[model samples]
Target: MPGLNVLAGDLLNVMRFYTRLPLPVFRFEREAHALPDFRRAAWAIPVTGAVVGACGALAGGLAYLAGLSPLIAAALALAMQVAITGAFHEDGLADSCDGLFGGASRERRLEIMKDSRIGTFGGAGLFFALLLRVLALAELFRLMGPAALVLLPGIAALSRAVALMPVLLLPPAGSQGLAASVPLPGLPAWLLATGIGAIIHAVACLWLDLPLGGLVSGGLALMLMPALAALARRKIGGHNGDILGGCQQVAEIALLLALSSAANWRGPL
Candidate 1:
């Protein structure tokens, strides 16, 4: 079994990589060495997602408690999440859109993705993605009220966990950037991450006594990951940080939409 210190270090490393949190610098030489190797620490991704999700949930809950409308509360939650993460995943989604649709060749697509400028396709993608998330979240808030706190974090964890699939299954699309630097995590790491996400979500579902619609939404999100990975491979050859980020965004939106639609049908939890 891993010691608490080891787990803590892994969690810190994950946070440093995944979020904009101002975590304290690790002074230990061993910790520093361990920090950059994402392959060994990939299992901590779900834990990182949980932290991000918790922050979003807290912001949304607070806004809801302040008597804001559900729509406003949901928007605040998403804004807070984007602010916390520096819009990292959303940026990837835009890049993926621009590259996948804007370019005529694989090389051209890769170049488009690498560029910082957002094109028409990228802008439209971001607009639609944000709109879908906001609408789904608003519906969830309307049905579940504060119960959305539990559901959002679960969805976040699951989305990140699913994002790992691309890294594990596909080669890097390019010879440089984040995908090339980090080694792909092995099966054990993937299993550990998946288990953590599943348990977190399953517990939330059981504790909340979520309806059949909620379960269906979660299940569909999980199913979408592989299809997304396949599409990425077919389009650009393989996966990258941008691809993984796009996967997470896609999964989150799908889950939220399903949950929100279900909530509308089933009424409040």
Candidate 2:
């Protein structure tokens, strides 16, 4: 019972660290302001992420069912998700793009990534990423109806865990932010996170009678993302919060597109 209680606290800690959601804390505490112990919270990443994703799914599904255009519903869903997370991952993608493309040297790249202002590459990246997500989701909802929205929680959860796995191998880019400060999880923790993500996605797919597009997307991300890791290593020496965020964003987009394509192949979603 004590172990379960501790686990629950750890999960809450992860949620507090990763999101901007308003959650209850112990009465005596001002708030959960301390950084989470990622080492212990690693397994809960997918669980916390899925909760956020489900909020978006519920919002979009309700809007579509309420007779709004699927595109508008999709946009609303995306907006809700952005609001919930405060666009945490999207900001990372922008920084990554700006740093990787706009800078001529490793130092310059890191500097660009650390800057608060978005550059031309960053702006372009943000536009395309958001556009692609909205369009893919709209098409998905059109084809699959509400079932499409149901897949989001699983995708959201899986993307987060899978995208950060590379960090287990790579070192930090600098000695400053989350990438540098958080304790590394062991192989067991990563495996636990991955296994839980897969199970969550599998249950959702089975419930919807949909193909295992989550696995396919996850596999593809694992295959393709070594390049990103290598690029980061060569460009800025190691991993950072922004780079990890970029990974999560890319993985999430790919999962959405893969599921959409798969549903289309299934005929009438």
Candidate 3:
């Protein structure tokens, strides 16, 4: 294990890569401004995810307490998240969609994804995904009020951590792009991340006072990734940063909907 300072540097590196926040660059840290060594930083990704979600929830929680409608509050929360992340995963989702659906051939699909231009499929997928996320957050807020805040951070943490699964499961799509350039996180990195995710999950369960419900919702979210991994494998023969982002989006959506369902369950009539 690294010393406290090394871990702190790793956390800072992950946060720098994951968001647009202007963090203080440490002169002593070798990779402060460069792409993170994700293997070392993988454990910190969930921590940063939790921080991002908590910041958003704080904004939304305040809005709800200020008497805003749940819908408005949910929107505000998501907006904060976007502002923080610069829609990093969202951009990846759009590109992945354009590449996955617009191009018939694998090479063409990868080319389209690299074009940096949005197409019909990309636009619609981004729109609906954002809509679904906002609506799901609203539903959770409507049902659980401020208590809903507990789920978002932990689930966000878990989703980001699990998003790394595709990295472990597939090869880089090509010799270019991030999947190929950066060293992919190995099993040990992923295990560290998963351990952090489990802690976050347990804390969320305790806070929400719903151990079974957390497991149910979080479990469904976990189940969603394998299908996504398979799709990526078929479409492009491997994974990339964009596919990993798509995985995060899918996991977040799955967890939100599952948690919403748990909140809405009213028992058999």
Best by lDDT: 3
User: 42-157, model 3: which lDDT tens digit per residue?
Assistant: 89889999989998899999999999999999999989988999998898899999999999999999998888889999899899989999998898887788778777788779
The digit string of per-residue lDDT tens for model 2 on 1-269 reads 23766677778878887788998886444335666667777889999889888999999988998999999999999898888899999999999999989999988999999999999999999999999999999988888787788888888888888778668767888888877787867778878887788777777877777656656766776665677888888888889999999988888888778777777777774
Ranking 1 against 2 by lDDT, winner: 2
What tens digits encode model 1's per-residue C-alpha lDDT throughout 1-269? 76777767877877877789888866542564344455667778888888888899999999999999999988998888888889989999999999988888888989999999999999999999999998888887777787877877777887888777887778899998776787668778877887787677667666666657557866887788888788888888998878888888998898788777766776776
Report, for every candidate in turn, its global Cα lDDT versus the true structure: 0.81, 0.83, 0.85
Model 3 TM-score is: 0.95
- Separately for all candidates shown, the number of backbone clashes (residues 3 or more apart, or on different chains) is 0, 0, 0
In angstroms, how far off is 109's CA in candidate 1? 0.5
Q: Which candidate model has the greater TM-score, 1 or 3?
A: 3
* Alpha-carbon RMSD, candidate 2: 1.9
User: Which runs in model 1 stand beyond 4 Å of their true positions?
Assistant: 26-29, 32-35
